[model samples]
Target: MSQEMGVGLLRRHRDFRLLWCGETAGKFGASVTAVAMPLIAVSTLHASTLEVGVLSASAWLPWLVIGLPVGAWVDRMRRRPVMLAAAAVSFLLFLVIPVAARTGHLNVGLLVVIALLTGTAAVFFQTAYSAYLPSILAPEDQPEGNAKLHGSASAAQIAGLGSAGLIGQVAGAVNAMFANAATFLFSLLCLASIRDREPRRERTTAHSKALLSEVGEGLRLVAGDPWLRTLTLFGAASNLALMGYQSIQVVFLVHTVDLAPGAVGGLIAAASTGGVVGALTTRRIAGRIGTARAMLLFELGLAIFALLIPATSAGAGLLLFATGGFCVSAGVVAGNVIKASFQQRYCPPELLGRLTASAAFLNYGTIPLGALLGGWLGTVFDLRTAMWITTAGVPVAALILVFSPIGRSRDLPTAPRPRNDPGYVHPHSEPSPRSH
Candidate 1:
């Protein structure tokens, strides 16, 4: 990589800048929807705990259903066009929510459908975007690019969370839904404006086989590799616990903790600031501590603090929530930075889409279950009891990493190890980046 590209990718690369802008805008919208959707269910529709969990589950259910196929599809086509289509689809889906609300037709059922459609769009866009990043920037520049994108995403999320609460307070939560629609439009424009286009990739004969076979190839690569398997499994467990707490957080804060809607948003925003700090510092921390050790530090050590969230209440007690949330968010984002860079560098470029999809399918697939578990626990035992169960599970999830090869290494391996190497295996010969 050129020195200019290495140090200032955002400033020097036009296409990357466009990609970053669109992704950041989209994340902002997602962050808004994250807060607004649950608030709408709780505040306007008067949804029950189980209903709230189902609502959250609807959004991620598509990942479990279509994630594998979508990965193969992304590998076959140009990624940008896929992302463009996904963005457009999400924009229309979100627009439907506010329109339905205005027409007095808004209901939990409609919200669930909208969530499913938009979530499907997210699966496509995110899968394609992950594969597309390495195409725009040199390999050496990727970590810097990832850092910038993640940092901005965190910052945007903070803004969006704070804005969602403010907007909900001022114009009602339905209007906040409209704002999320607007952010998708902003993402579309930025993405459409990008000049760097993907070169067309040839369809491999492997694609001619059954689609299931293609999907299996991707799944095998992840399942067969120790590094991928460990990280993916850990991600699954972590998300289960993370989403379990988050699925009912609004309900917990509102009914259990007795906070106002705006205060809830403010607290979430405050906690999310840790993501910004994590993204900014992940590279430096990884350099100092080894990447593998840093993963343990951020993901394992900080996760213990998640138990503090359920302990929160009025006044000084709220700080416990913020402090705990800050550590968890920072840890998660830091771990993601490490993971994203690792996946990009370590995996074969040809299978990037499928690799991402396979991992996400497993990682994100747990989300719906977690949401349901949280909602169920809240309904059956009480919200605080549910929080205790879920929050404590976060640290326990980290034990997977402690036992994996990551625990023994200073840094994660840069390349897949050849088969016959003790305890490590590379299932497929690494391929070069495709033209498209």
Candidate 2:
């Protein structure tokens, strides 16, 4: 293991090491599937843009629909089981693709169903992960741990996607899916290896209460807190902007930039490269600038660079969009590290899972809309005009945070909010809890 890694930083803790290794493998496998599934829809199934949109939406739409309820359920049970089961099911789901493709029965409807199932498994994995880490690490180390997870996942997306793209080209799409299936099997093995007794907090199927009330409670904390509220709102706004751009990316690259599909996919892979760099280096850079300033300024720069995309000539659009992607990726990585760290700090471990889920529901709920908007808007207008709309929406994020605390400060301890308290602790300041 790398000594400087977050898990390495906790090298003496055997259980955490096991969990870390498992999550790393799981994240990598998940990324591979995320990339491969889309290719299968486009190539083997001959799906149209509307069909592809449904396939894509199927992946994230569950997060909006069932994320909170699932979070509540996971919080009520042992998370390790949830994690292990998710890995197993994901493996089975991917395996179905190759089987269906071979049988000559693969269709858009079936692909959509598969995407939704895979997405459901992903929700479990993520919900367990969000709650699991805070319990394992001390408050101070949460940021480093989160930074590592984000960094590793971003690298995995680029690496895994790049590899899958190559496989799709070299072999057929059906054969490429085997890679994802293989990854899931490895992830399942890793997850099964974690032997630590799950540590539980105040457990509840909190959703059984009035769904509206539970939602309100989670929303209230975020809305009531100056910092948390700002981060949540900004995050939602950011997702709307970014997802909007991503949804239309293929069209923009194809229609406006005049690139072929393969070239467009490769450009996106290149753009995510910057995000990987940012994730790997978040801790060092944030430590030097303070988390607050780093997040605030980087996001502003991200918006500016996003605006520069539509202005490039068609001949150079690929390069310009690639450069813009670099900035957006960097900003998202850095911003997410700061924001998630801040959230994990002030949130109660008991509320962490459900709260995270509820917040995810709001932020990601807009994503489906963004994708729909991008596809429809791109189809209707000049692709360049759609890009302009996506880029311009970035300011809405800043606007949401303008009156909140995130724009002003950076790091905070990942402890739950004190009962009606007024201050926060930085995780690095009091990390002895993790050494327990």
Candidate 3:
């Protein structure tokens, strides 16, 4: 790393700046769609509560379908091209929605299909992007880089969500999708402008292994490592509870809380400001208290406030919802910053892509199920009842971290244990050559 890239990376590291801008723009667009998609389903198509939940589920279903293979494939190829292709595909898919709506062809089914395709693109983009980050910055600079990127992403999401309702109301809800599509174009341009090049990965014998074999290696890596195992399992559980309530949030606010469409966006945007704060402060907090303690505080302690979400109503009660949302957002984003830095330093570089995919396969796989569960509970009982059930699960789920090995340590491990150590379980009888 050059001196120029040391402390003032944003001003000096041209490639990283480009990557940050592209990623931030991409996050902003996705946030816009998060609000716009459900709004379109409810406002324009007159979708039922169950149908809206299904629409949310459709976006994450691809992780279960293709997440594993995509991770292995990302390992075989350069990451940038995969990201580029995925972005292009997403841009075109989102663009189709407005056109379809204009032509009188938009329906719940079409909306579901678009969500699924864009979700597939997201799986590709996210898997590739995770593996690509460590290649750009030196290990020492990674924490700072991660903080800046995550903070900007949170900021962008705030901007996107804050504007979504205004755009939906001013321009028709269907047409607001144009803003989402345009962001991808901006991201594409930013990515294309980067001049740095990654060296070609030489095709060694390990690279020639069977796809399923490679996938299995990734899975075992997560399963065998106690640290990785704890985090990955907690992620899966946390997401299940988080997504469960989030999938039906819009409907709950609109019907049960009796809030207008515009208020929904404002409340969510306000709550999301906590993510920005968390991202910016995580490194400092971790340095002061140690990463392991920070994790407990962020995931378990702060998450207890989730119970407040179910108490929300039209006027004065809305603050309860925002307060709960803010705490949850802060906790999740802070936990992610710590986890990202840990994984980058702890895992072998050769296996990073597989590790990312395998972990995400478990982590994100539960999203669709959670969405379906939220929808079903709302349909079977009532939206408020569903909110209570799901919101309560948020803190309950964090108990996984408490009982696991993470709770006993003051700091997370800096590196994996040696294979010969009893604490270290190798994925295979003999280590693969690449692992050396």
Winner on lDDT (1 vs 2): 1
lDDT of 3 by residue, 1-436 (tens): 3334435888878889999999999999999998989999998999998999999999999999999998899988888888899999999999999999989999999999999999999999999999999999888888888888888899998888877877876776777789899999889888888887777777884477999999998898889888889999999999999999999998999889987777788898888888998997888787776687789999999999999999998789999999999999999999999999888987877788899999999999999989999999999989999999998989988898889777766667766446334356333322123321
In candidate 3, residue 71 scores what lDDT? Answer: 87
In candidate 3, what residue range of length 10 has the lowest lDDT sum? Answer: 427-436
Q: What lDDT does each candidate get? A: 0.89, 0.70, 0.87
- For model 2, give the 10-residue run with minimal summed lDDT: 427-436
Order of models, best lDDT first: 1, 3, 2
Structural similarity to truth (TM-score) of each candidate: 0.95, 0.87, 0.94
Q: How much is the lDDT of residue 426 in candidate 2?
A: 43
Candidate 3 to truth, TM: 0.94
Candidate 1 yields a Cα-based lDDT of 0.89
RMSD of 1: 4.9
Give per-residue CA lDDT, model 2, range 342-416, as digits (tens). 777778766777778877877777777776676666667777787788878876576665455544444444456
**Which regions of candidate 2 deviate over 4 angstroms?**
1-7, 200-215, 254-262, 310-316, 410-416, 420-436
